[model samples]
Structure formats: C-alpha cells, structure tokens
Target chain A: MLASLGRGRLLACAALTVLVSGCATPAFDQARALHHAGDSAAGLSVLISAQDTIPERDQLLLLLEQGTLELFDGQSSAAARQFVSAADYIDAEDRISLRDEARALVTSEATTRYTGEYAEQLLAHSHAMLGFLLSGQAESAAVEARRAGKRLREHEDTLDSATFTRALMALSFEMAGQTNDAYVSARALPAGTWPATAARLAQQLGSSDADTLAPSALNNALASARGELVLAVATGQVSTKYSSHLNNGLAWQIAFPAYRPVDAPTPALSLQLANGKTPAHERASTNINQLLRQSLDARAGALLARQSLRLSAKHNLAKELRAKDELGAQLLAIALFVSEVADTRGWYSLPARFDLYRVAVPVGADSLTATVRGKSYTVDLNALDYSRGPVLRLMKF
Target chain B: MFRSLSRSLALAAAFASLALAGCAATTRAIDPGSDIQYDAQYSFSDKNAIVKDLTDSLLNRAAYSADQAPIMVVYDVVNETSEHISTSGITDDIRIALLQSGRYRFISREQRANLKAELQEQGAAAQRVASARKLGAQFILAGSLRSIEKEQPKQWRLNRKKLVYYSLNLEMTDIQTGEIRWADKAEIARESSQPIIGW
Candidate 1:
C-alpha cells in the first residue's frame, strides 16, 4: 500500500512538471538565446525545426517569429511567405477551440490554446504587407493592406487605425497611378501624431481646400507638395509574463501572467535626406503596448476564476490525499505549488513598440540615412523598384 | 470505512455533475430568414432581409415598376467588404425575390450564351439576325456591400464585445437616361463576445 502511494506521488510530480514546463516550446527559448547571442542564422534554424513540434494552436506564433526574423535578415521573399501563411492561418476559423475552455476553467490559461492577442494578429498582417512592399510586390502588398484593414476593423476595437497599413496602401495606390484612390486612403488617416503625413497627402490631392483646415489636412497638403519620406520604427520588447496574485479567498495563491515587463532598448532615429538636409522626424503612430494592456485586462476576470478554481481543486485534492497517505498529500501540495507558476509563453520576439516617422524630401533626393541605435540604415529611393514614384520605405533597425 | 466510501462517492458525484453541466449542448432549427449564428462575420438573415427590403423599395417606385413591367438587368453587386464574400449570391437572392414580386422582367447575364446559341441556330438566312444590334438593358440594377466594424472598449474577458456594422446599398438606374430610378440601403449590426480562452 505504501509503495503504491509513493508511486502515485511520483506520478503527480511528473504530471505537474509536464504541465508547467511544457507551456512554452523549448525551441522558442533556444532560438531567442541564439538571436540575443548575435547568431540570428542559427536562431532561424531552431525556429524552423520547432515547426514540427508546435501545436496547431500556436502555429501562428511560430510563423510570426520566423517572418520577423527573416525580415530582419533581409530575406523579404521568405518573410513574405511566412507572414502570408500566418495571415491565412489567422483568417481561417481553425483557431477556435471549444474544448480548451473547460480545461482553462479547471487549470490555467496555459492549459488552453493561445490564439494570439488581437494586437499580435493585426501586427502579423501588417508585417506580411510590409514584406510584400519591401519585396517590390506592390500589387500583392495592396491586396494584403486591404485585407489587413478589413481585419483590423472587424477585430480590434481600440481607437487606433492601422496607420502603417494605410500608409502602405497609400504608397501602393500612388505607385499604381491611382492617385484618387491614394487620396481617399490618405484622407481616412486619423488626425494623430503618426498620420500627419497621410492627412497632408490628402490635402495635396485637393480634398481639403478650406482656409482654416484641420491640422491633419494642412500636414497632408504640405507633404503632397514635397515628396514624403516615411520611416517605420520598431523599438523595445513587448510585455513579458510575471506573476500577479489575486486573493480569491483560496488556500493557495494563484500566480498568473500579470507581472514584470521585459523591456527592449528603445532608440531614437535621425534621418539624413538625400538632398543633404537632415530633418527631425515626428512620431506619427502607436507603440502597441496599449493593446497588450487591453488584452490582459480583458482576460483578468476569467483568469481569476480559473486561478480560484485551480486552487480550490488543489485544496480538495490535498485533503483527500492526506486522509490516505501523508507523504502523498505533501507531494501533491508541492506539485500544486510548482504548477502555479505563471504561463509566460508568448511571442517574446515582438518589439516593444512600432512607431512611424515622416519627413519631406526634395524631388532630386533619391536616398536617405536612418540612424537608429547608433547605426545607419540607408533608404536608397533610386535603387528601390517603384512602379511610379517612391512613396514609402520600410526599414528594420 | 462506510464514511470514507461515502465521501468518495460524494466527490465522484460532484465531479460527474460538473462534467455533465459543462457538456450540456442544446440546438434547434431556426427560421433561416431570422436566424443569426454566433461568430458569423455576416449573417444570411441579414442578407435575406436586405434583399427583401431593397426589392420592396424598387416595387414601391412607379418609375421603376411602370404599367408594363420594366425590363431590368442585374448588372453587378460589388463586394466592397474586406473579406472574400460572394456578392453574386446576394444578387441572385435579390433577383429571385424581385422576379417573384412581378415588378420587372430579369435579363440573365449567365443565360447570354444560350440566348446567343439559340439566336444563331435559328437565324437560317431569312431571320436577318446576323446584323441586328445587340439588345441593350433598359434599366440596370447595381449594388454594393459596405461594412464597418467597431469594437467596444476593452473590458474584462466576459464583457468584451466586437460589433460589426454592415450596410448593403442598392440602386436601379435608367440606363438610357443615366438617372437613378430607385435607391435603398439596409443596415445590420451584430455584436459578438468571446469566452475567456477560445479563438
């Protein structure tokens, strides 16, 4: 009887270890470590290999990381493919899982499938469109931009319009000689810090001719006169998982993913226009951390319920075990404690913020230098294959 | 021993109850014209109602439905929606409802091949069909589906709702005069909220 009890305790410990540790793919950590160690090539290899092991639910996350890494490596074609696949996967109804809900209520979010946060979904679509744009496939980029716009309107409720996406679309329309359509797209730009250029483009199109124009309209008209240069900036780490305790009148404290943030270094960019003029860029877009905060707040109540239920179950199970074997009861308590660790599994490769900057360039200016993190990235307008005129440039730093 | 066994039985019963409660599934057939499925980006009932409403507007207009039924061709229904929606399906529904109302004679774009073949096979030299000008559509029905989605401010998981607004705009134009004879729009709004963990 004693031997049997010991075996049960050992099995419980094993189960708890598996439950808590397997929440995140082991390969993700390995790939991240490689990237941090300045071996992105090897990190790419790790992610590629991890595909076979990733569950269908988390496949979107894998694709997102791979796409971003490929973009960083200047393999725009490969990155575009990954982003397209990720976008397609997200569009399909395959991610919805009714079964995971029950498990989530009984255990924690780690037990449920992680169908990425809304921000991540929008960002993935944007990145895919960016890939197509960078690969000089403006037509494909235009289609993706439309799809992303539709998805953003359908899924995200935040006041933020997808400025980067609209900018890409405007550039695409401008290149295709669909200036009217480009003007319409630019006009849709929300009057904000990031969309000032788009508003200005609309004004240049003569859509806003009022003397006392909206600030956005004025900016749009001015930008239309001189060629506009757009810089998309990615900085810092997105949120990371830490434990947040909720006192739900339970015997055990529940540790959920509500803790410390993993911050990435944010760098300011300096632009040197091809016309020998260096202009200071203004912030025109969002950092997307607000989205992360909203997603977490949305999940808080449900997470608390799950945490409370899990603790209550543990308490009951421990009591039951104590009546049978003291050693088994103690082992179960330890197992519960171990399993209570927060599920920090997420797309840790995501940048802390995605911001946009635009500056006016002269007609003769065909290149520019974007300095970020003390390194220079050249935007060669002349070298870029634009069907009409270069309207926007995407650079990763 | 009796008390311990009872305790075990009670625990099992509680678990069984929880399991059964979680497994409860109920379903019923609904009137297709009014049924709304959860997570539907666009509902069939909304489409059906839009078609009926638009058809009514056209029928109410004496200019569109003259003493003799006006000959109208359904030109196109543009899917200006973000998603890949088959606008033709909605147009077909509109066509059927319009025909049943006896408001107009419908010229089929799909049947043009058959019409051409019949016209050619029966021409037989004396028919004088080879040089005849193509019959133009008298009035044309054209429409577009436009959608805008709004999300409520983020709240707790149980309270977050995504609201999608869809507007179906239709117009009948006098092709010869290039003037719109009838125009109408139908609007649908649907709100969806997700459970804590599901997609």
Candidate 2:
C-alpha cells in the first residue's frame, strides 16, 4: 500500500512536470504567423497579451516585437516608448530570481528566463533612439545615442561594433547645431573616407583649424548631402532548432538559432535620385545575423548546460511516470520527444541589414524614389526641409 | 487500507486544485520617502541625491540668507538624458525644499496662464477691474540634466562592471542685468558589477 501511494505521488509530480514543459510559450509563433500574414495589428495585440505570461527576463523580446510593429505602423512615439521600456528592462538585470533557478533544475531551460543577448540589448536602444529622432525629439535621441555608444564600447573587442550607430549619433549632433561634436562622431564611422570628410566638414564649420579642405570626390559629393536616404532590408529569417551533442557521458539537447550562412548574398536596393544618379546599395556596416550568431557562440557552453538541465528533468519525470503506469509513460515520453521546441523569441520584424545612403538633394529636387523588390517609396524632400539640418527618412521592408 | 487511500486521494486532489488556482494580486500604498529599489539604470535615489546637493548649495550661498528671502522664478528644467526622465520632478523637489526653508520666494509660472485669463475677463466685465500688474522675478533659475555611461567588459572571464555618471547644472541668472549670479552643480555616480559566468 505504501508503495502504491508513493507511485501515485510520483505520477502526480510527473504530470506537473509535463505541464511545466511549456515554459517558452506558444504566443511567439502565433504572433509571427500573424505578422507574416500581413495582420500586424493582430500580431501586436497577441504580443501585448503575452507580455504578462512571458517571464521578466524574456519580456524585452516581447517589447522589442511590439516596438517593431509600432514602428512599421508609423507610430514612432509608441515604438520609442516600447523600446525604451525594453532598454530599461535589459539594463535592470532583474530577469531571473532564486526561485527561477530552482525551477530550471526541476524543469528545463524553457522554464529558465532568457536575458537578451548583448547585441539585442544594444539594438534596442538604437531602435528607441531612431524612433525618438523620427518623432522630432532630439534630446531624447541624444540620450539613446549615448547609451548605444556605451553598449558598443562594452563590446569593442567583439565583432559587434555598430558603425551606423556612430553615424546616427553624428547626425543627431549635426541636427542640434553642434558641429564639433558631430565631427567627432562622424570620424568614428566605419567608412574609410569619412574621417577625412569629417575633418573637412569640421574645418568648414570653423570648429577646426585644419590646413586644407581637399576637394576629394567623396568629400565633394557628401558636401551637398542635405537629406539622408535610409534604405533598410529585412532579408531571411532567424529560426531556432533543437540540437544535441554528447558531453561527459550525457546527451545534451540545446535550442539555439542556427548559424547564418557566411556567403549569403546581400539583398539589392535600387535608388532613383531626382538628379538621374542612382547610388549603389552598400552592405550594412554590421551584419545583424552574423553578430547574433557570434554572440550566441560566445556563450554556447552556458546555453548548452541550461538546455541539458531541462532535458534531464524531462527524462527523470518520464522515468517516474513509467514506474507508475507503463502505457501512460510511453505515450507521455513520445509526446515530449515530439513537442519539445526551441525558444525562438526574438525581434523578428527587425531588418536583417540596415543600409544607409546619402543623397545630395540639389535644390529643386522635390522627390526621390527608393525601390526595394519592385516596391517604391517616394520621399518628399520639401516636407523634410533641410534648411534647418539634414533630415532622416527610414525606409524599411 | 482502501479507506485510507481514498482519504489521501481526496486530500491530493484538493491540494492540486488549490495549486492550479493562481493567487490574486493586491495593491497597497507605500511611503514615497522610503528607500527605492535600485534596479533601474536610473533610480529615485539618483534624483533625490542630486536634489539634496543642489538645495544645500543654494542654502549655503552668501547672497541669500535665512533672514532675507530672495524672489526667484524657475523655468522648466531641460532633460538631456537618453532615458525618459521627469526633469520637472527634480525641479519640483528643489522648489519644495526651497519653499520649506523659507529663504527663497518663488513666482509660480503655473499661475501665469490663469492670471492672463483673469485679467482679460476683468477688462470685459464692467464691474470688476483687475490690475494687470505682475511681480518681477529678481533671479531666474534654469538648468539642464546630462548623463554619461561607461562600461568595462568582462576581462579574462572575471568581472563585468558598468559605471554611470550624471551631472545636473543649474544657473541663477539675474533677470534685470542678465548677469549670472550663482551656479550650482549636482553630480551622481554609480557602479554595478556581476561575477563572470563561464569558466
């Protein structure tokens, strides 16, 4: 009788563990499906509803998704607010608690919270600052620029240096009429010729005493770049898969995004300027997919350990279930094997690559057409009056 | 044995049901002056410390004494930080502290719009004649809040630390001559660190 009762409790515990296996939640995929179906409003609603269920550690992922949706819908202020919330959450370091760690030991990494990768955290602030800039809040944008700079500096030794963030900071400074600060920021861009161009601009603005402002082709072309043409491309998807490897006599099952192909072709973006000159599309300074892959590789060991813990828990639970009822245990084990999923929660709406093109909007050039995959977006140069300073137009697909 | 097993089953079912039912959250009022949680990149303590330092400097100024109160007007405090912070909250704290000290008199800009409406109404009304006169501020207080963040990456898989520094500068400009009479600065610095994870 005592043995029977013991088996009964074990069965109950097994059932509970099976229920807890759904730690990553299914809302992410549901939202993604909705987004792919062109129902972004529905996708945003799904994410907002899932916010309460997502662990604090993983809440930034949901916030980033919501921000991206808002940005796509042209609600820059709302997008900025959501991204700011995500930045604060990432900075707070309040994702996992002692209770959560204990749960991971009993369950799996699905139960363990997901604090974002360093690259995602930095990108959060970049998107937030961009939203602020689009909404005409220069002071708030400046603040985000500082945060992005600090984040990038932290990852200086890594291949995660974001040159576009530096360029954005320079643009912010130039818009605020701080030519000296702008020059310093522009000089840090990844462009090989920007340093000389920046120095020339500094001298022209009377902020530097450089001897000569040479008339180089790039410098001469950039001199009249009153308006900025931002061309962003969302190419390919970031998907996670469950992988297993043998380590220390145990088969360790882990969930992570697969490595991005190094030889992936860059998507083409065609620009038709009013001056009848088309600028060739350049690759983004930092490839986001490559950066994310590198960041995950750096912490592969830790991630695998967490995944192994969850797999072990599932195994223990299945063994206990088998001891109670053989047939029930067999069915549950099969279900676990089939239903075990990877946590692929990330900002899927973010562009795989963020490309920027400078347009020398000669006076009387009223509009410019940016074509991506046969879809064209027209920018009214007059609407973004460059008399005050250079204006930014974010074109994303 | 059968009876005991039945009783245990009933108890187990009750416990499982209770566990499945999540608890309801409750709300309560908390003291505003209590020590705030140090989780945010920016916290209430940072603002509170800045306010205290700035107010202390103002109180110590030789130009204004406890006996003679100085009349001042506070324009809006500009937030130059990337994070959305309430700059007015800091100014409100300073205003409250100064008013409590009784060494400074403030002309409320919040009342200006209402005052203008009241004067116009008096002009339209035949019976009531309100004066359009207003008190001139002896000094205008305006300032900007700025922040700088620095981070030291994990070295040799040991420690990771992030340092953030904030500077609040307030200048008291004489309204009459436009000469800056007094300037005070409040600075706050914080450092947070975490142990290395992977060996």
Candidate 3:
C-alpha cells in the first residue's frame, strides 16, 4: 500500500511538471543582455522565442526595445513598425497615455532657469529630439521628424498647460495695466451644457453673419478664456493667491462661421510652434499673440465680427474640425473640446525669485467620452460649435 | 508464475476484442517519403537580414492597408516550413513599420485581444461600433521550406559523399478574393563533400 501510494504521488508530480512545461517563463534579462551586447540579431531571436514564454507585458517591452534599436540603427520604417507592434500589445488608454507622456517630455522646457523656481528639467528631451533630427542620417529622418512634431505639438500645448498659458494671459493683463497673480484652471465641461447656449445665440440672429457674433456671448467666452489662462501659466504660491479672471453677464450678440479652409488659402492662424529647441528668452517674441488673434477672428467668423461684436471663445480647433464635416468626425472624436480649463501657478524667474500669477488652459488634444443606455461612446467636444447651446448635437451624416 | 502470465494474456485478449483502433501513414502508388529533413544554420549576418526583411514585408502589409476604412492591400511573406513559426514573430515586425510610417497607425494586439475578450464576456455588446477588423488588410502571406537529398560513392580512399538541398517558397494571397497576387521563391542549396560517409 505504501509503495503504491508513493508511486501514485510520483506520477502526479511528473504529470504536473510536464503539463506546466508549456507555461510562461521570464525572458527580460536574456533579451536585455543580448541587446546590450550589440547582438540585436540574438536579442530579437530570444525575444521572438520568449513571446511564447514570457508574460504579455514583457513582450510589449521587447517590441519597444526593438523599435528603439531599429530607430537607432537607421531603419525608421522598421522602427515605426516595431512601435506599432508594441502599441498592439497595450490597451488604447495606456497607448494614448504613454504616447502623450512621451510627447509632453519632448516639449518640456529644459532644467535651465526659465524662472528662478523652474529649472529647465526637460532639457535632455530637447537634445534627444534635436539629435535625431540633426543626425544627418537619411533613413531615420522620417522617425526623427515624427519626434520633432511631437515636441512642437507639446510646445503649442504650453499654451494649453496650467503654467504657460496662464502666464501669457497675465502678460496680456499686465500690459493692459491690470493687477493679476496668474492661475489657470480646467474643469471637465459636459456636452449637455453647450446646446442651450448655442440655441440662444442661433435665436438671437436667425441669420447672423460670421463677423456679427454677439458681444455678450463673446464676453462670456473671453472672460472664461482669461480666467482659465490665469491658472495655467502661474506657479504654486501665485496660483492660489492670484485674483481669478472668470466673469459672466456679457451683452448680447450673434456668432457665425468664417474662414472656410480647404477653400481658404491657408490655415488662418499659423504660428511658429516651438519644438522645445527654442531658447526661453526667445519665447516672448514668438508667443501665439498673432496666432491667438487670427484664431479668434477665424473662429468667431468675420460675419459676426462685421456686426462689431467680438466673439470671445477658444474654439479654433473645434471650428476647424467641424468645418471638415464628415471627414473630420474621427479627428474631432479625439481632440480636447472644452469652453476652457482654469488654474493658477507661481512665477519662477531664475532662482530665489518668485511671484504669484494666474492663467487659463486651452483645450488641445482633449476629447470627451459618454455612456448612454449602457453604450460607451466618445466625441471630440472641442470639435462641436461652442454656441450650439447644450444638447448633444451629433454627427450630421 | 504461469497463472500470472495467463492472466496477463487474458487481459490483453479482452482489450483486443474491444475493437482497438489506430492510424497509419500510407500510399497507393508513389513512394510516400518524398520529404527529406535537414537543418541549416547561418551566421549573425544572415539571421539579422532574414528577420528584418521578413518583418518589413509583414508589418507594412498589415498596417497601411488593413487598418484603412476603404481597405487597400500590400504583399506579405508566409512561412510554411516545419520550424513552428508564429505570425507574431513577423507581425510584431509589421506593427513597428506601420507606426513609423507617420502615415498609418496599427491595430494593436492589446486592442484586438481586448476586443476578443470583451466580445466573449459581454456577448456582442463589447464588439459593437469599434472593431479591429475595420482596418482593411485583405492579403495574407505564406511560404514553405523544402530540401533535396543526394549521395555519391567511392573516390580513391573515400567511400561515399552526401548532399542536402534547401528551397524557400513565399507567396501573398488576397484573403477575401482567394487570389494569389504575387509569388517568389528563393532557394539555398548545399553539397556536402564528406569522405568515407554512407547511410
């Protein structure tokens, strides 16, 4: 009986190991070792083998490494493929987040003293992107160009961040002889809030031209934009201490579309977006002041403006996406759409030097997701007309 | 001892009577063993190139065309050799290529796998509206590896010699239309000069 029991146990143990022989094993170290040894060939082989052995996440990491190597090895098309393969392994949310973080790093200012409090911490990032672009390697230019664009896009987003946009707004206020501690703020604006406002405007003027937008609506939008800007560009102490710019009760006016692009000669508000390669001191000369005005004019519609009422809203991208009609729907679904995001920050000039300020964060690369009747869907809220008056106006087609 | 042996025989006979079934390899006319097996190894140079080329073809085909709304096509190479090839090895390559194109984005495996799981768990509700299949990748690639065998006998003090041959066949086909859009075959042949070798 004892012998039989022992035999049975032995058989069970043997069976278990054999069954689990096909189970996953860790391969990260081996892949790393091979890759570092300059044996990309061996490293890739091990990676392929380990995809069958390692956890799914490791496989993603390996693919990321492969893409990095390909990019470094002057095979960008190959590199792009590797990145896509890695993307395939991760969730959409994670993909977007990681890519977004990477993008942020690209545009992030270096640890140099742009202000006393904010050292140019993201300088390495600037160098990295520029290195790729300047490498003079032909095969890798496409990959490098993509990186450059990411940094530029992120720089433009400073006009959207809690620190930068607010500061710019403060500059505007300061230049206009107003007291301010810059603070930028952002609140999730639900789609339900816009339709009624839009309907009211649509009612005010049955056929208002693009230039004839209502002063009341324009003021509300401007006040909101200024409020948001105050929070976006300032620093810690300044953000909390600054006086807010958010206001209400504007005089009435009409708003309509203007500057039909694709038919128009060019993007009306084209600004030289800094790709993090530009010096901080050079920023003021290149601020989106010109771009912002064009954006306002184009978005507000000349027809509304011709009526002598300024249309005050950060609706540049939103208007553009909508103008594209059916073709733009997909893009609109992904962009950030909000009347404004408001916050505040401290001003850090070089070191031991600081001041309070306020800013407004604009919606860029922002988006909206909604659930109705147990169904999940998202819309590019920024793509919607700000004055449509809150009622979830969906795709026309 | 005799009784024990007798019992074993009796049990075997009982099992035999239960219509025990089996399978076999058979042929009617031609010699069935046309396949000759051989293994080949290449230096680091060849290994690197092979993976790169194969991956490029696979990824470019999958991403640019398959994920498009209207759907377009490109060619891919398929491996049909007995080396236990996985599409992921190559498809992973394809994914990287497409993402870098700046012109295309890939449908990630995570996305596809999640869709599969969601569909399974939620049963139709999960797969509604968004589908990875929306990217129109209509073509798939495939290929095979084969070898040839030859032998020679006696030269001076040497007794015999053996040779092994290899060939790789690659093809791309329209998954929906069942058409072979393109085909190409590359072969690697080797003649081993072995002295005093026979099998």
Q: In order, what lDDT does every prediction score?
A: 0.64, 0.64, 0.32
* Predicted candidate 3 versus true structure: per-residue lDDT over B1-199, tens digit per residue: 9999999999998877664533344557633224332323222232234445554554545334434622222222232221223334444444454455553443546555765455434433113223323444444445544444454532355533456554545565655556776555445555544333221
Model 1: per-residue Cα lDDT over B1-199, one tens digit each: 9999999999999999999999999899877767667684876777787888777777777434435777666644655554446677888887787778776776666564454455434533223122121344566677778776666654555545677888899887676666777888988888886554454
Across residues A1-397, which tens digit of lDDT does each residue of candidate 2 receive?
A: 2235455564455456556655455777777667655566788888888778875656767888888777766788899999888887776553335666776555444554566767777888878877887887766777777677767776665534566667677666655444666677776776563454476657757764455434455445556555444443343344443333333332233444444354564465666767777632233345677667666676678766766776777677667767767776665555445334444455666555665454556556677787766767787767775543446667655
Can you give the TM-score per candidate against the true fold?
Answer: 0.62, 0.71, 0.19
lDDT of 3: 0.32
Better of 2 and 3 by lDDT: 2
Error of 1 at B31 (Å): 22
Q: Tell me which of candidates 1 and 3 scores higher on lDDT.
A: 1
Q: What is the TM-score of chain A alone in each candidate?
A: 0.78, 0.78, 0.22
- Misplaced by over 4 Å in model 3 are A1-397, B1-39, B42-47, B51-91, B94-105, B111-136, B149-165, B175-179, B192-199
Model 2 stretches with alpha carbons more than 4 Å out: A1-27, A33-39, A45-58, A93-96, A159-161, A172-185, A191-197, A200-263, A279-284, A307-341, B1-49, B52-83, B92-142, B148-165, B172-181, B189-199
Per-residue lDDT tens digits of candidate 1, residues A1-397?
4345575655565476547544778787788666545466788899998789987657777888888778766787789888878877765533336686555543556765565666667777678767776676655565566676666665555425456566556665554334565666665666654355455455557664333345654354334434555666666556666666554444476786762554554556777876667754445455556666666666678667767787777677677767777777676666665566666666667666666666655456677888777767887756643323444555545
User: Once model 1 is optimally superposed onto the true structure by TM-score, how far is the C-alpha of residue A350 displaced, in angstroms?
Assistant: 1.6
Residues forming the 10-long window of minimal summed lDDT in candidate 3 chain A: A230-239
| Tens-digit per-residue lDDT, A1-397, candidate 3 | 2233343353343344333322223454555455444455665566666666543323444555555444434454555555444433332222123432232221111101111111111111212222222232221222222222332343443322222222223232222112211111111112222222233334433534213433343234434431221111101110111212222322222222222222211111111112312111101112222222243333234233332321222133224435445334323222221111111111111111111111111234243332222433344434544331111111100
Sorted into a CAPRI-style docking class, model 1 comes out as incorrect
**Model 3 residue A126 CA deviation in Å:** 61
